[model samples]
Target chain A: MELYLTKNFGKPNAIAMAGYLKHGGYRALRKVLKKMEPKDVVEEVKDSGLRGRGGAGFPTGLKWSFMPQETDGPKYIACNADESEPGTFKDREFLEKEPQMMIEGLIISAYAMGVNTCYIYIRGEYATQTKILQQALAEAYEKKFLGRNILGSGFDCDIYVHRGAGAYICGEETGLMESIEGKKGQPRKKPPFPANFGLWGRPTTVNNVETFAQVPHIINKGASWFRGIGTEKSTGNTIFGVSGHVNKPGAYELPLGYGLKDLIYKDAGGIRNGRELKAVIPGGSSVKVLPADRIDVPLDHDSLTNAGSSLGTGAVIVMDDTTCMVRVGVVLAHFYRHESCGQCTNCREGSAWLHQLMVGIENGQGKIEDLDLLMDVADSLEGSSICALADAAAWPVQGLVTHFRDEFEEHIKTGKCTSPDSFRI
Target chain B: MLSENAKKEIEREMAKYPEKRAVILAALHLVQKEEGWISQDAMEEVASLLDLTPIEVREVTSFYTMFNMRPVGNHHLQVCTNLSCALMNGRGVVEYIQRKLGIEVGETTGDERFTLSTVECLGSCGTAPMMQIGDDYHENLSEPKIDSILETLK
Candidate 1:
């Protein structure tokens, strides 16, 4: 169980460059600069089978390769620090505790892609995290890890921190590029994917903060070593941010394909207050919810996808027996409704409709016919918008209703929530 | 109007990006920091500084939840009522703050000391039932903790 990401968590001043250097930081950047070529770095990552830590889970090396090697103008690398997905707070840990690790990783990625500039497009709400990153960037620049020829490798690069203004759609690759361009955080239609045309109309590649954080380790430990840690399709360890009804709610750096049951009981100290496990959102709020019976599934990208969910940001949100599924629907639907950027007609109108229906059900005014209506609305939202925001909105509702239809029915039949008010607002 | 220092900060941010339009968010932030909210005049001033139209700046301002188009109290209490926080009784925290401050969500107190809001999520779910006051997150909230935090704030 070699910890790739959280190994330096408890170390003193791990956010500082000196603390990171003491813990063998930037050696990967130096190694890449000295021995390995850009294509070698890219191939090593592809060989490791490392996927994006963001929700999409695309192969990282293949993505880096997509950047045109012979681009005429300035190509860019955007490190997405906009960790806005609900139940997913693992990226915040790296930003606050191990900023240098992620920064070093970003530098290596910039070198691998032959990009001279990288922008860490962080969310606006992360004001404290932003300040820590700024300080860490200053330290990296002073030590010659960033800017000009780094460690005398003839690689010139500069990383900038761009703050996003409170929009979840900005987490979308194209939407992020738009925000970085100082415009509304709206998603553009793809086919002109980011690798071909991105930020400021130049070629760009965006990786999650944790995705880039894994690069330094993969280079230092080699590809086969990383491939040995996690499941076959999903390689290496990831930070799972567990919250809600779990007794010990926090980020746990576990190898991919770890048991969800163990993650809840052993790592997270089981359900809070000796409550029975009712349901779990294995990934973030965007993925499908798993009932208590499905907890035996190994947590990973492929396994979770096969088990009717995806490992989205690896944020596990647990719910105990006392929780109300109707209320859960209301909460999730409300979030999607509020955060939708109002670009596509289906997402803009459909998210509101879904929220309205969920709210009616929660308020004891829903008819049984509304159940089918909810499903129809949720289905329409999937793959119908300019970005995945609509799909993210749809999945949780579908997950809740698909597995916990009885709860929704009970509310409509009895005209009141049957679950205890202890967990409800 | 933007102050001299705000303009300087905006200029520095402008140099970081290839295009000047990209500094609009930073420029808007500077205007809001100095004036408590983004005024029409401030938007116009920022637009002039960044070579964007006032409507362009206004559209960007309205799109984001953080930029205050109108005035706010000295302390902005943004409670996260998203799923994780809701499971941890984030609504209770919002209600408690409402009773204590004598202001509901999206309302400023009569004395203008606190403005209460229920935000979506602030990414502090592990330490849930949290809220952000100014730039700092007040997490793992309880009745007593909320009292102590409010006492210190005023």
Candidate 2:
């Protein structure tokens, strides 16, 4: 099937924009503004089985429905462009190539949620993306696609681009909201999700950049057509950012339930330099690892979950035999340790302890029982925080050590890494 | 109130917010752009400008890694040591800079040209072993690349 979303990548700027316009760019917003009620827009989105692309996989329509429907306070639609998950770079590419699509998505989502002002909280390091998006927003405003009385539909909305200061925790919805509000970006306690008390204690809906980008498509091609692309449970094409030990390592927008083997072998052109695949982090680094035997599993959210993993952000990190599993654990643990917002005790302390222990094992200083201790620490941090940042830190360690306990044991037994000579920690 | 220049820059940011205090962080960013780092006086000034308390300004400043509370060098080197970068020898790149500069993380060089800090992911995983010197991303870095980058900065 032809790729609709990323089809215009690398084309001439005007041609791309024209193509996007032809294939229903801002038509969804126009339709919503002219024909459908805001409530109906929300209902249609809820009917379309679109899920959050920022690792959580929550239903997009359900999330939009959470916003206070009758509130008179200023509401916000925040685009969670802080895609800082370890191996996720799809959103960055999407924004850099077709930023107007993302902007249109944001505007449509904002109008649906009754939000007049919106913010795209981009990662600070995405300098190119920020410039492109900001430029796109300007072009959009000049064309009356963004600012007041958009398209003469009597619906006024403004979208702003906010840059984050390179914090992974900011990828969380509440943290993104806090960061956009010019705060520290630590996650706040729940029971007041962003749908209720967000962006200055008013009602707000934080949706992932890709999730919002899908709105225009869903509206343009009716909800039934959108749902027909992927699977019954996991619908539509997802952009999988394939990296690590792969030949064609780039973002491929494929159907959701595409086979893992087909993704790696056929689409990615198999592993680089003819190396045998050892494991794959199907989602970003936060999800559980799957061994080579599970490569035949479909890459849908439900399938991966049943296979003891998640299709998180669609960042397929392929690992080969040359890689040391202990080193992978150590490297990922170090990230969680550094990125923890330190708002909650378990996450703040547990991530560091897990890192120290993983380092000890990788550096040949671990006892055999340290494996259990690593799991124990990860367990303590999981679900013990205000947001999923802690779990993002904890789950990978738990998965790595659980699936590759033999590698840790081998390291402890040999007092050194057992991988090939080039696999140095 | 903030200075005219600061206010103009902040007004652009405040336009993004429904409430003025929502742009407190942007105000602090503008203050840092002018003053190099956030001083207590600058925080107080920004608080008044955003109609927030000085404590609120201070809390916001201290919370984010990007905002420097005290003085820094003329240039700030933010090396990304997160997972993807680490897989590509990010740790080694950071160590090389520290040894060459003779200043540890969070310290300015003796010449006051650079302040090196290891940060979380910079979201450029494709170009692993990346560093952000100001707004520019120096990605796929090596020892030679690092030497050239530092030399140009100096």
Highest DockQ: which candidate?
A: 1
> In terms of TM-score, how similar is model 2 to the real structure?
0.92
Judge candidate 1 at residue B150 and give its lDDT.
90
DockQ, candidate 2, vs. native dimer: 0.45
Which 10-residue window of candidate 2 chain A scores lowest in summed lDDT? Answer: A14-23
- Top candidate on lDDT is 1
What are the lDDT figures for the candidates, one per model?
0.92, 0.83
Candidate 2 lDDT, A1-425, residue by residue in tens:
75877887777672245555765577777788889888888888888899888888899999888887788778888888888888888898678788778888888888788888888888866767787787788878877888888888888898888877657788888888878877788888887777888888888888888998888888888898888888898988989988777777778989889998999999989987898998999998899889888878999989999998999988888888887888888878888888788888898998899989989987889999998888888888888988887788888888888788888899999998898633343
lDDT of 1 by residue, A1-425 (tens): 77768888868878798899999998999899999999999999999999999988999999999999987799999999999999989999999998998998899999889999999999999999999999999999999999898899899999999999799989999999999999999999998999988998899999999999999999999999999988999999999999999999999999999999999999999999898999999999999999999999998888999999989989999999989998999999989998899999999999999999999998899999999999999999999998899999999999999999988999999999898654665
**Interface CA RMSD, all predictions:** 0.8, 2.3
Output the lDDT of residue A131, model 2: 79
Clashes within 3 Å, all models in order = 0, 0
